[model samples]
Target: AQSVTQLDSHVSVSEGTPVLLRCNYSSSYSPSLFWYVQHPNKGLQLLLKYTSAATLVKGINGFEAEFKKSETSFHLTKPSAHMSDAAEYFCVVSDPGGGYNKLIFGAGTRLAVHP
Candidate 1:
């Protein structure tokens, strides 16, 4: 079975500061990791993903994640935080047999940006 855990339930950052949301995953095989963000009144949006191609994967909105197989972690980071970046972020791992249909999501981290 594959699962993901988000280290923080809430993260607060001042505008222009660095942002980090930690995540750890457990999998038996090479795992597919993803980060999704959902705003107050919107659907989940794909932030980034890792599928054994590159350790460092970049996504939209100046966000990126590093796939650390050794640590079983794929933490999301941003050089600077923006007001629009505040949202509920979920760390997800896909089922090896189920493909895109089956996904395991973490508890989620709520990001709060302050000016």
Candidate 2:
């Protein structure tokens, strides 16, 4: 089984400022970790993923995250925040043992971008 914990329920930032979203997970087996973004009623979009191939993974826009095995952490970061970056973020955990289609998502982090 795999699970995720989103440290914050909300993150606020101003335009052109740095943004950070923290996440952690646990699993019986090595799991595939992912970060997805949802804007309003739109469908979820894949931000980035860690598949044991690389430690640091870069996603769309300026978003990036690092998978730390020892800490079981995958925290997302962006050097500068944009107004359009405001959205709900989810940290997902998936295990091949569960067919890879099953994903356990975190509660979510709402990002509010100020002008």
Which predicted model would earn the best lDDT? Answer: 1
What does the lDDT read for residue 59 in candidate 2? 97
lDDT of 2 by residue, 1-115 (tens): 6899999999999999999999999988877899999999999999998888889999999899999989989999999999999999999998666455688899999999999
Which pairs of residues collide in model 1?
Answer: none
TM-scores for every candidate against the unseen true structure: 0.96, 0.94
Q: After superposition, how far is residue 104 of candidate 2 from its true place, in Å?
A: 0.9
Clashes of 2: 0
Best by TM-score: 1
